[model samples]
Target chain A: MRILVCVKRVPAPGSRINVTPDSLNVDTNHLGFTTSPHEECAVEEAAQIVEQHGGGVTVLTVGPSEAEEQLRYAASVGATAFVLVSNDTGIDWDPQQTADAIIESIAELEADQGQFDLILFGNESADSGGHQVGIRVAVALGRPAVNGIKGIEVGVQGVTARREVDGGYEVYSLEIPAVLGVKEGINLPRYPTMKGRLASKKAEISARETQVAPGAQQRRRLHQPEETVIETEILGTSSDAAPKIVDLLEELGVL
Target chain B: MAGVYVVVEHDQGQLAPSAGEALTAARRLSDHLNEPVIAVVIGEATTEFVSLCEEHGIPKAVSVLDPQIVDYGPELWGQAMAELFSLTEARVVMATGTDRGNEILAQASARAQIPFVANCINAEFSGAWELTRMQWGGSLLEDVTLDTSSLFISYAHHSVEAEPLAAASATQIESIEMNLDPVLCRSLVQDRVTLSEGTTLSTAAVVVSGGRGVGSAEGFASLEALAGLLSGKVGCSRAVTNNGWRSHADQVGQTGTRIAPDIYIACGISGAIQHWVGAMASKNILAINTDPEANMVTKAGYAVIADLHEVVPAIIAEIERRRGNSTST
Candidate 1:
């Protein structure tokens, strides 16, 4: 089995995020980047599959050269190959365009390998989190697709995967050449070790473009969220009240 | 030019509540767009399915009955919906944004080759879509302009209010039989795996959630008892899962399940952005924490100044007292 895991690099989870100076897009400048935590789990799950099934793991990502870091992170988790599809077409493509590019690039990558087995991806990327790429990729590739998978195992004919539904876990099995959108808790992703990091350094990632792009735009409406965020600040009263605060804190055993 | 296309999701015979919520979204969007709503339910059932839809507020209900579609298969649902989409020029196709809803939209988006957006919290129509999309698990908002004349959008279960219309005269229902190829599909729902030992979260009305501040793994019993008294579900924070205090299934976050309950009470939870994102849409939130500075104190509908040790037991006692009072009455 040759497993392909797709990932995305976005702003680190804890870092402060900002829109561009023009208030148009996420301000990529000044923010640290890392692989989406969910994708990390997907890579770990794919690695476990290869470890048990005697196969190789390949990582796929869609972004600029900066996105190679996500692929490297996947390699550090035991992926053997890396494919990057960039849309340096002087514009940032929407989710559809990104999926199209990934669809085309995945075909070429799988064709080079001659026969592909599994395609694993995060349920949604942290930043874009479009939640469409994997499903679209499955459709574009004409393969079985499962979403929100929490657990998985390799089977004789195909693979067995478990996902969350309305009531409980929905168990499924699909033949090779299928897609799965990995949810958290599927597996505990392993941290990159010194050895795995060094192996990742040696990986020369592959990248390309796609023929399909966003065909048209739709109407409705868009804007910022209506919910208001208010910050509150309260100050302690006078010195006498400060002593009372200390007494109250002592009563609560905070002192 | 304005009409609602309700995306139906089902497993075996039971329909996901979000299916009803999808109909709600469809009705609301259609109302906003000044268009009528049409519901498309795809299943293997022959007769009962059509009436089930007609009883609901779905006018022009199209039931694509096929015997082979026993489980939720995205391709078959997408293909069937695509045929329906061709028949009707739906200005907006809305789904519940569940595992199935999101899947159908993704497949339909690719098949239709149109821009697809997921988990949209707000949408408007002034000729084009000015949309506000959640980013980084709702940590921030991305305001983008989708000029697409028509597109596929899945509303996250709790993101949009599921407001059904008042029952009017008999709703117009239409059923259409369709053809589908079961082969070329790679996966099937073999069985349902149990996540919780009891009380499916879907049935939970009032939920009491815990967080890292709960500290010890041994204290879950107290929380469980409190939840049992309220007939509610037990919820955990992502931190608790990370700490292995609870199983990941009980985790409440962006990755975890999104629920809309009558009342959500938080205990010892500082409320991370991700956790709040999942629970923010709850009808009401009451928080009890030692740290008065906990972020949720402001966000919750009500805040209590007490530790889990001191407060949860009291809440349980109150619930038991209420039950006793009701029984005596």
Candidate 2:
């Protein structure tokens, strides 16, 4: 019943995202970081599974050294183990390189401890949104994988996963040692308690390393899309605006 | 000869909404690369599917109809696509950037040991593949170069309008034979559970969305009333969901449902980038907030600088009054 969750540290974007002068990375001077929303739910889902199945959850991440903060956050929220596949390089790794590094690290961890029964990942990173790492990892490992999973249930023989589709859900059953990419709506993650925070501060974090190779895709630059400034027509400033709104709705054929 | 391949998504014997859009993208690539475009269908390419393709100006298509692939499985579809890529020596593979579309293409590209890009808005080949893709849900754009000659990419949803060729010829559908491994079926869809019947958030024509200013879960009552009166749906921002005032199912943002309604009524929302990316696709936006300087108010097509609590009830009453007068007449 051992479970592993993979997460990414992303800057919590406000109303707007500002890029660095070089356009190579996000300007992080005043920005704060948090685990991608989807991966936070993945960590929560893994922890809840272990809580009910009588096992431990391991949280893993691949990012800069500062990502250790995210790993510690996971520990505070029911993760029993932490693995940081350190990427000290300032430049972001391509999807292929990231997937390769994660696959190699997973093999190393399994060599030390027994193989995990399940591994979970966010459907896509909030920043890059490549939507490939989990599927690539599963394909390399020859394990069943599905993305956009919102529901999961563990049974005696296999695990049942539900992927949200239009107007319904598509359910799949896979044997143990499977991979899944969970979305944000899967669960509402809990906040860290005082005791959990203290424990996480003292918890040990395992750091792993991988060789970097040039990936097929390389980022040239990042730029913001030109914002179209619309001349917003003010309907009114008080309840009297309601009639104007109704008239506009009628013009839009909504009424 | 190397050709461009586009994977068409279908459901319940009809082409999915993004099918034509994906083909349009492939057609663009095909014209620029001077290669033939072929549509690949994982399921049976029925007469209706062929007609739809023909209507969309598809010149050629390959149908991979295997009994083992009765249900959708990422691995199975990936392998099938991988086989097709090798058999045809495809130069480019494209699909719509959907959950299933991205999954299947990712798996296929992995099997082919090639690079895959998602949410690409534009792509061109000068010498190598240069792509402009949407990052942060279209708030930002990333220009990247794919070193590989064989390209695998997904078009950003709604990036290109679906248009049929000016003079499209009869579409030719050819069935291809492949040896699919049964192990891939491990990821096959085993069951389906219908959550709700019709008019979900994504499909709703008009969406009345609330944000943090809506106050609490109970505060969504006016929103629900407005949506019901408009025969639309009710949505909330991520803040409302995080506050535990609304379920995540009702959230509308980059992390939530990407909605494309005719008109999106945003109430009490400050309009963060995450939320704006989802609502930007709507034809028109009307923001009702007390703060005139809010992002939602400034970016919206129309605005009412007032408290939603006060304005929503008034709007509802006005609509009812207009309706009653028309009925009396």
Tens-digit lDDT track of model 2 for B3-37: 88999987645778888899888889899899888
Report the TM-score of chain B alone for all candidates.
0.86, 0.98
Interface RMSD of each: 7.8, 0.8
**Candidate 1 chain A minimal-lDDT segment of 10 residues:** A232-241
Please provide, for model 1 over B1-329, each residue's C-alpha lDDT reduced to its tens digit, 9 standing for 90 to 100.
45768776766756666666676677777878788877777764334444445545666676676666666776777777766676677677778777678778877767766677787766677877777667766667766677766767887666665554455335455667766776734465778866566555544676778988788788777789977766688898888887878887787777776766667778788876668777876766767676777877767655666667756665555556556877999
Off by over 4 Å in 1: A13-17, A28-31, A87-92, A207-224, A228-255, B44-57, B194-198, B305-310, B313-329
Across A1-255, the per-residue lDDT of candidate 2 in tens digits comes to: 888898999999888888899998988888999999999999999989988988989899999999999999998999999999988887679998999999998898889998989999999999999999999999998889999999999999979999988778999999989999999989999999998898789879999888968888888899998778899999999999998899899999988
Give the number of the best model, judged by TM-score.
Answer: 2
For residue B177, model 1's alpha carbon misses the true position, in angstroms, by: 2.0
DockQ, cand. 1: 0.30
As a whole number from 0 to 100, the lDDT of residue B233 in candidate 1 is 89
Docking class of 2: high
